[model samples]
Target chain A: MDLLLEIAQQVINGLVIGGIYTLMALGMTMIFGILDQTNFAHGELYMLGAYAAFFFSMVLGIPYLVSVCLAILVGVLLGLMYEWLIFRPVRGKDPLNAVIASLGASIFIWNAALLVFGGAPREIPTPFLGEKVNLLGVSLNVQRLLALAVTIGIILALYWWIGKSRLGRAMRATAQNREVAALMGIKIGRVAELVFATGGALAALGGALVGPIFLLQPSMGLLAVGKAFIVVIVGGMGSVLGAIYTGFGLGVLESLTVGFLSSAYRDVISFAILILVLWVRPQGLFGRTGERGG
Target chain B: MKTLPYRNLWKWVGTGLLLLIVPVLVRDPYYLHLINMSGLSILLAASLNLITGFLGELNLGHAAFYGVGAYASALLTMRLHLPFLLTLPVASLLAAFSGALIAYPCLRLKGPYFAIATFGYGEIVRLILHNWDTLTNGPLGLRGIPGPAGFINSKVEYYYFILTIVALSLLAIWRLLHSQLGRTFWAVRQDSVVLAEMIGINSTRVKVLAFMVAAYFAGVAGSLYAHYLRFISPDTFSFLESSTALAMVIVGGLGTFWGPVLGAILFTWLPELLRSVSEYRMIFYGLLLWGSITFLPQGISGFLESRIRKNCTTGVARDAHS
Candidate 1:
């Protein structure tokens, strides 16, 4: 019974982390679904958001929530620039070229961050610093709770936007088949822009929420990108719902593994799951076979 | 065509002679070490090209093989007192095994999925290297790996040794490209499902073969690197390292034999030359990669070929290589 309670507690902790993963993966999936290219640098966009928010809160003394909005704005603008500067020119070339370009963008962002921000970790000034919430005898940090709440809010808003709005429907249509959607008079380029910006926005939100939880650093995006890739794969390539579910699943699994198993193998666990899921069920739990995803 | 063969042979001979005389001319240990690093970079990049260029898979986990080879050989030579020469083959074999392990699940996926899967596999290798402290010494790294047979006694000697490895690996790739397997690789790359199946070529087997061969040389590069540097660590082969290797291939020109070689040399030298301004180095490197891909899609060698021939026929020739 005690062990069960411990496991449950660990699970709640996992949920908090999972929420962040869900946001990051959602953004990545949106861009990948529309662009048919993986932004290896998506995490860098996330990183940019974190640094931007960090600067805003630390230097300008902006509130945490307001800093998050600033992070989203930065994310959207950077994402637009990435589309214009990186993916736009390589658009119609071999998809592999885009991959390389994304890699270059990733390196540029990562190294540029390293150069500008330095290697040291920076603390994101959070309003919830040293605040804790007691939930079922488990002490949860208030920052974690706020982060989770923000994630849920973003997911709900995204669902509404995707479900109700005309642009959202158009984005979904574009995702289903870019050529057909274009043929149907959808502005493919505009849709691409919207998706990229939204992707960036989501990633920024994730980064802002996470900055307060984990100390900020230039390389923070690398691990987030890796884990986001895993969640996307396990959740099925372009399925937003799948990404959310798998994100949470991976988070819980990671927490349980760290709690019961060796902490050292936690990363290995994700990689192993990636390989296993590919071998056993490449389509993922919710994915349709032969779907149009890379 | 008649003069082409003669000119190419002379060019090869000239380059070979140049490589031979460089050590004697520039006796500086730092330059020699840099040159050796270039040779290893060439090997790693070219090996990556075997998959991305020929096999047409955007695998993101190439550093896994390189790191595996380094750790595997480093352990053997340092712990068991095995000859460095022997450990090279053993380490490569270990890398090949891991390559084979990673390939089966990943080969089924296309495009970005393949890239991410390989990337994940790479992270798994790095994780093992980080956590498995007893064998890898964890983050502290293995030190004092002796050079090959003690004949590689100095930086120049080690430079020559690595140069030999790079040359042989290039020769192997060249030969492979001219063989039936090379054609099969192109066929698979063109369209894995239809043409390969029509020709009764197992696309999976061909991809795995390319991966194995690539892993072999990457391991060999890792082995040489470990012996030369006399140190090994998990951080040495990060995801960033894998991205760098991919950049070298892309910047050098994918699918061309000489492109990655030139790219490796230039990239290795460029960053080293910027050692004083190290902070801005990566930003420059990243911009270079972006600019090259955007401006020169076919890469430096490809551009040169087009300039000389006044046509893109060489690209076609590369595709239809015998």
Candidate 2:
């Protein structure tokens, strides 16, 4: 049957680029499971929330659903100015000094967006960029079924706001034990500034839903923060549905290794499956080998 | 305990004769190419301050073992012609055999899972030196090379041949940080389970001998930066050159022996004195690496060694009350 409908249209274009790498590895595995601090400028705040939804739908023309809620309110006001000017004065210092001050605020917001948006790349326009559909006989691409229906409606509204809110049970009691979530009363630095402003508003709604379909630049947040750190190290660093099932199983195994190997070894097969899953499961894939310290 | 005191051996032979007569009184081949690019960024910020400031370990892919010792001394001196002082000890033994083969399965993971498994083995060695390009010519990198000729072709003989290989790798990392195996690698960085119960000392063989002596002085500063900028590429060892060699070992203060030479001479002359804010030079190098980790976290040589240990404990308590 036409090679099972061309391997089900290359597994629905590798589950719509693994539903935009599971909405940019669900805001980098919920700010590395409540601020263990990777945020190496969380892919330059998902390239400044796709240039704040491309300057709100191509320079204030608006309505691409109100420029994806104004690129998640400018990625929650640049994740509350990166937790009020860099992680509330280096919270509990020496997590390698907040990973070298979030890699010097991701090389100062990618060289201040290469000095106010210049290192080229741009393009936004979406409303299903030159649509397409078909179905059984296959064909696809209505912007990869609207990026798999906005990544299954933002992974079922971040699994009902992280399993029914109360600020998601004080961000799962401050990621299990921030001094037993500050001795139960919670307020562990306002649940790490509401998990770094809901992980910089879900990495600026995954750079305003993968900026139309990949263009915008300023070094496109270093290969979407190195494939969202190989989908939060093969989905484990404090799980969030194992970074949405290992960011759609590493975006359908890097779109079946760029359709049968060699899109210049598709980011060397996702950095050799992130150094062979940190040499065979260094507590990833839903971690918990004694939640090895932050 | 006070043995080696001929006035501290004439202050270590007058600081190795003022680092061999201050590059022959400033010969100025653009200040000996900014003192041979601050002796290859003080041998990559003193071997990334011996794996993140003397083994507290947070190696976010130390410029992938200084770009695997500058592509193994630029492919053994451009396709096996060798002899740049035998391709600097075969690019510091192929960057200490790829830092003891990625520190024997990543020092069996610790903190930030060994800094995201050495930032995924420095982006899988810069994506196999950018798609192997039939042995790295991929990103059109490796270029001319050949420099360190007879007496290293001038610029005051390659600034006294990279200041005699950065004073013999800073006197073999100050004799492996003043050995008794450098106090069991500073008691496995202060307290690896009380230096494995008061001194049995293994702490994973002193963190794989401080990650093979900081990947053998970052493969002799990537074989003197592939014989002084013959040319290299993989965007000159990115991860923003391992976050400017961990911001010159945390703004030059971490574990102090002249804090990665005053944080590799003020983060390589503060991007050449903010090259006239050439387009907000990386937003003032990200506001001087977030204002030197938010207000000098013990940097400027640990704020001048805690004001010279508070003026030598108030001059030995006013010379014991006179």
Cα lDDT tens digits for candidate 2, B1-322: 2122355698879977987788778866776688788889988888878777767788888888888888888788778888788888878888877888888787777766687778778888887897788888878878887776777677777777788878878767766776666656656764464645565877777788788888878888887887787888898887778877877877777766668877887777776777777788667767677778888976677777667768786532110011
Standalone chain B TM-score for every prediction: 0.93, 0.34
lDDT of 2: 0.77
State which candidate has the highest DockQ. Answer: 1
lDDT of 1 by residue, B1-322 (tens): 2112454688979988998989898878888888889999999999999998888888788999999999989999888989988899999999988888888888778787888888888888888899888999999888888777657787777777787888888878877877777778888884556867787988889888888999999999999889888988999998878878877888888778788888899889988789899788878778777878888877888888777777555544442243
Chain B of candidate 1 achieves a TM-score of: 0.93
Candidate with best lDDT = 1
CAPRI quality band, candidate 2: acceptable
Candidate 2 lDDT at A224 equals: 77
Note the residue pairs that clash in candidate 2: B179-B182
| CAPRI class assigned to model 1 | medium
